[model samples]
Target chain A: MVDDGGLDVVAPIGGAVRDLLRAAPGASVDLGAIDPRSTPGLPDEQLTGAERKGWARRQVELVGRDLARQQEMLFAGAKVDPDAGRRVLLVLQAMDCGGKDGTIKRVVGAMNPLGVHIRAFGPPTAEELRHHFLWRIRRALPPPGQLGVFNRSHYEDVLVPRVQERAPEHVWRPRYAEIDDFERELTAAGVVVVKVFLHISKVEQARRLLARLDDPTRHWKYHPSDVDARARWDDYQAAYADLLGRCGTDVAPWHVVPADRKWYRDWAVAHLLRETFDTLDLGYPPADFDIGRERERLLGTAGPLKVNRS
Target chain B: MVDDGGLDVVAPIGGAVRDLLRAAPGASVDLGAIDPRSTPGLPDEQLTGAERKGWARRQVELVGRDLARQQEMLFAGAKVDPDAGRRVLLVLQAMDCGGKDGTIKRVVGAMNPLGVHIRAFGPPTAEELRHHFLWRIRRALPPPGQLGVFNRSHYEDVLVPRVQERAPEHVWRPRYAEIDDFERELTAAGVVVVKVFLHISKVEQARRLLARLDDPTRHWKYHPSDVDARARWDDYQAAYADLLGRCGTDVAPWHVVPADRKWYRDWAVAHLLRETFDTLDLGYPPADFDIGRERERLLGTAGPLKVNRS
Candidate 1:
């Protein structure tokens, strides 16, 4: 099984997986150039179908445990010092049938839910529409020591409005810089903004949608609106490429994952988190009190003590 | 080792564990009479220490998978019918060193974080104090289809104030009836409230506290206030007994779990969740759209389509 090779005790922390996946800053993105079926970091050529999937699943689980431990430290550090302001926000954006839900269940689900907060942004309500585009997004930012996952996010403002002609160029164009500034602000305030775009081939999406339609249990996942969205696939791809190029920042570069393979998609996302957490160099918060004195006091007070009932 | 015996597909669901653990409504609770070290339904006597612990860990994992499946069905059901209002709220109450955190990490963490919302209620903030005691709680109640876990809940109002004499008898006394009414209202609103009290012996608590003091990594979990709370263990127990007797209702009963053994504590909580979910009898929401038509439409649209960019 593809484990972390005991990273907690001996192996060096994350680097290679991230290096393979991260989009280069200032580079123009061409979605057509990236292969949605490629396994960037794995030795895929040597493995059979089941073996590759099993390897990816094992890697996801291993990296998830490491993420869980790092998150505990993040949570513990905040408990010790509320002013630390350290937190992580993961922003996931994908086209329909691009494996966002699968990634969340297989990868993000591995963490202790106590420290994970998830918010799925759908179409705006009447109340939400009246506010600024980023209003709802800001409200959902993870608090100190939390790992927040946004299933579809403020990027929707740029994508849907532009593709559907709901907003003019002047309105949605500035949102790119606005989003960059907003993310930069979040980064400045100690939030590590991890952005990922799940890259799925249009053919794969059609296959997945057909499967959803074929299965009664999966019917809840499909809708007529999905077909409408599929019809605008090329426009959606163009919009995604624009956002990927414009939103890439020094602190929060966008990673494009080949999401046609469910296992690799889940593994890549989990590995991305592992690599990000590794950079934090988080340690368990130090014992704030006198350990020796507290231990002695604890040992001395072995007898039951009474409270005044009055 | 100890699985759910194929509860999903083959066997009957959810009665035995719940029946073994529920506190009888209106019955007087005797904290001292309950053995904190007892493994109520498990055959602990036949197994050695490691074997027993291993069995508990395996049971927790197995039941956790069942809980995960049930939660998915619940989420899917709600997605199909937003008005269904079906949701589960798990209220966890325990003394310091009584394994509330352990239960959350090992059991609740087993579910997908996407569907699990956890709120740890500590002392109320100034904003919270300005509102009704249930106001903050009402806001944190799980929305439709999600599993919400409250670690140390509104029962704190009754326990802390009464034991510490922060509120006069008349002021704090009526809260029992008030809490009962509040929970009843929640039950009427399609929420299944699973209340659990982790019962730990004072001697065991002292040992856990001493262990915290002995380990630097765990010191962040300890506070001097915990020692003070430990000093008043008897008063707290009395307060717990009172609330357990008064607040338990037909729809929402409280279960008392022996929590001296960490593995058993986690397993029991997971089992409790499994039993609760079983009663829900949740199924995937039916496909509102025409499956045959959608399948044909999906198959017809197999070719790459272009979007108008103008």
Candidate 2:
């Protein structure tokens, strides 16, 4: 079992899930070898398809409650210590139709929206392009007591440019070090970086894309160019493998979530977050002012005001 | 019952909740007439206090689910037409310990964080004081297809300045017209503004503050200075009454929620959101692309990718 960062509470699923899902530092990922349907930390059971999905949904809900409490503690801690520098940045990177939005809805959505900062980084705008790639990212970092989610993050810089040939090898290769250095600085400043790569097979992508087309309501999500990305499946996988291998660091590691089953994918992401928060050993901050004095002063206040009747 | 706006689905609550809670446009508000313990939209039941709270909690959860779906429709509609200019901005204003944070965590927290933009307005910084009072607020308006919440809002300018004598009446007085014109512009631009005043009794506020002081874990929330604000409750109430009377308009109305009961406060705010979204007649936007052609292209893509086993 992986160590529970420093959480006093029992983890929903032991460190086993996070440990199993964590992409080893400096190890190459082979998309084919990881079964998208495999329930990594869940026990093998004789359950029907519907039952499995229901079970997974329930587990995610439970994890969400725990996450909500932990998040409150994180926010409270930051409030208590403005200089705490304790914050979480969760980076979600996925291919087209890989369920990044779904993961966010089910997992991050569970936290109080007040303390969560979500930024979906699409293609760089003209203004964004004028600055360094990390400029927009740096501006969006969560403050002392917040959970920050990047639906698509800086890793896109490496994956997209490399596969689409939008940038040269010399241009894209050094981004790994640039990213590492940036993450190192964030870690030093008390940011816990959790990077996740949603691994969906080419077959699953086709199914999801087809489902979107079949449902008129979902058509807004589908684009003709999604096929173009799928057409370069092999190239994109190679690019991802390289980035996952090179960028996975001791400070901020990558977790590859098999994305074939939507239910399993949602639960796994929430599990990863629960474990991450656990490691923070979060607790509520002590009151800075004199509690006894405050209580006396508070009680001394007058009762409900006598207002003029309407 | 109020008009259902254009909603195709049944509202978790009829218009009674919003209608009853609404602060009539141009009508002066008397804090004394409004009973903080009254459950405005609920049935006069034969249930115990615990049962009432339990019922409110469950009802809030149900309303939240509906709000989630409606919010998705709002998001989808926005995506289908970025120019739709359709968004809901919920502005929350309250006294100290008035349950604004609790409302956000329990009510706004029900929706996905992806499409919700939240800003908590605090005392102005040196830089913020340099600009027009509304400048910071204008910058935080929700983009199309999103839900935006203001924990404390532009109304603060009218309330704090007038009550605390931070600015002379000449400066703070005309802000009513400025705020009305600003909100008018927002309404013209397709923003549906839902303003709420979390009305807590002074006794309840004192009780809450004492509870915070009593709990070591809650000490971070309590401040010795909170009593300072409590001391000037009457001034703040008069300030709130003035703003509520003037700012409650047709385009953006104010809802005065009795927040003595935390559970009921959560349900009330959530129900307000549900009714507001329903009135907008939110729905998913149709696919912008050629669905039929995309389906053919997606299906023609090769099956599961053939990758070398690790």
Candidate 3:
């Protein structure tokens, strides 16, 4: 199913994706918009969200496997690159318990450890809260040719603080501009920032929360605050609404996937990645110096060695 | 720190680690056991569990990074190991939402993906459950010099199936022996199996569950089924205790890591890894023929091609 003669690697990379990100800077895009272009389409009219998620999970696993192979090729004297000085930053933020860990598992599986890095940000460390919101994030940037993933990211400046009003409204508001500038810098300097907001419905979230409590294997995963937040769902929704309306720009827009169905989410993510890599136009760099050319270059300039027999 | 220097490299490759597994197959060794071997008079006034865990997390991060570098070096130019039949299988199981994902992140963060493989098992698909429990797991064993990490594994045959009563108690109970046999077979075949069970307290689980609900960005991560398991806390604990008590073995023993503290869990995993790799004694192979040796062998044996023009 070639969309346009071949794998239609659409979804603006250096173009619209980057441009919109730059324009809004801290804004998130409705990444679902990139659908049809990503997975082509599945003909299962009867598939449930969970089933879709399973399929997407498999797709992600395959993508992760692909990343692993690419990494091996690089180690084999290949000059594949992101040209991004040192990292690919993945930002995953969703309502509490949004499967960030599950997403991380499937997405990063089979990746080269040397070239992939993961940083998870929880309630900010006291030291973290004291600094500018982006401080912890800036420190986690992946080294060149590396992929750096953030379980939660600087977006929390907008997300958590806004939803909880933990920071004075005024303090948290300026962060949008600051985040825009920071991401812009990262993009211009070669870092491709991919942000995913897992959009699960409130009911699904409640269901997952209850699952945590019911599964003894999951008991350690429960928390009282989760019940508390369930009470404040409305506030979070309003905050998210404001976020979507505000942050999506040209340089580093967020990809808001409908996480209500994980399969769709996973497929969407892999598709996005395939498109991004295609856009980078990545290829093995020409050998340091062509061996043939190098031999010829020395052929005429070299003199014969002195012989001991003389 | 030395833990009795019984591991001698003179033995064929992988023999030392294998021997250790065979000896302690049933004893659940706390791989993260911090020895005071060198600190004879150190005070025992340790930080509470939380602080200790924090320190452990930092330590694991450092070690994971180092491990990552080593894997990269090996992949760069190392010869294919002659004892290339050995591989590693790391199995991590925990109460729901315990730091399984984080453990993978910190532990495998630096591993070279060229040879390592990761698989996460959830409730089996209809196809998987229809056959023997070991079907999916048996397929993922890593090749020699490679690593295979399992997030949740065959233990589920004993863990979840027991709690849910999906099969008769007799069925799951005996599967434990089967699992032991399965892992034992893996070890005999050169698989270094290391298993970890993160044990978190009920209170801690409550805190994490709450965190998911409180954070809007993390909301989709919760599920209703989680609560159902929590209500059956006693049943799960019994299942875990039975599995731990029965399955902890000399060849593939479990590490009962106290999970109240996340950092400690991380530290313990990193330490377990260091011990596993360091204990393996992956020494270099004998050198290939040098130029002199090559010349001797080549006195009559012509090399590739003589320069043109003779």
In TM-score terms, which candidate is top? 1
- Model 3: per-residue Cα lDDT over B1-310, one tens digit each: 2111232211112333223232133323333242211111111134343344334444565667656544433332133442646666788888776778677765775564444566678789899978899999987565465567887898877877778877788888788889889989988887788887777655455556556545543434445456567666667877776677678777777766655555556655665666676656654333232434433332323224322210
What tens digits encode model 2's per-residue C-alpha lDDT throughout B50-142?
A: 566666677788788898889988988887788969999999999999999989988888888888999989898899999999999998898
TM-score of 1: 0.92
lDDT assessment of candidate 2: 0.83
- Candidate 3 docks at the CAPRI level of incorrect
lDDT of 3: 0.58
Per-residue lDDT of candidate 2, residues A1-310 (tens digit) = 2222333333334445678888866646776788877777753344554566666677788788899989989999988787978999999998998999999888888888888999899889999989988999999898889999998999989988889999899988899999999999999999999999999877778877877888877877877889998899999998888888888998998899988888888888888888889899999888777767777677678555444221
| Reference A-B contact fraction recovered by candidate 1 | 0.61
Best by DockQ: 2
What DockQ, between 0 and 1, does each candidate earn? 0.43, 0.52, 0.02
Ranking by DockQ: 2, 1, 3
Q: Which regions of candidate 1 are displaced past 4 Å?
A: A1-15, A26-28, A45-50, A304-310, B1-15, B44-50, B304-310
Residue A37 in model 2: lDDT: 72
lDDT of each: 0.83, 0.83, 0.58
Return the number of clashes found in candidate 1.
Answer: 0
lDDT of 2 at B59: 72
Clashing pairs in 2: A5-A279
Residue range B1-310, candidate 1, lDDT tens digits: 3343454421213346678888877745877888888778776555666677766676677778888889888988888887878899999999998888888888888787878888899898999988988899998998898999999899999998899998899988888888989999998999899999999888788888887887777888998878778778888998899888888788888899988888778877888788789888888878887888876777676776333111
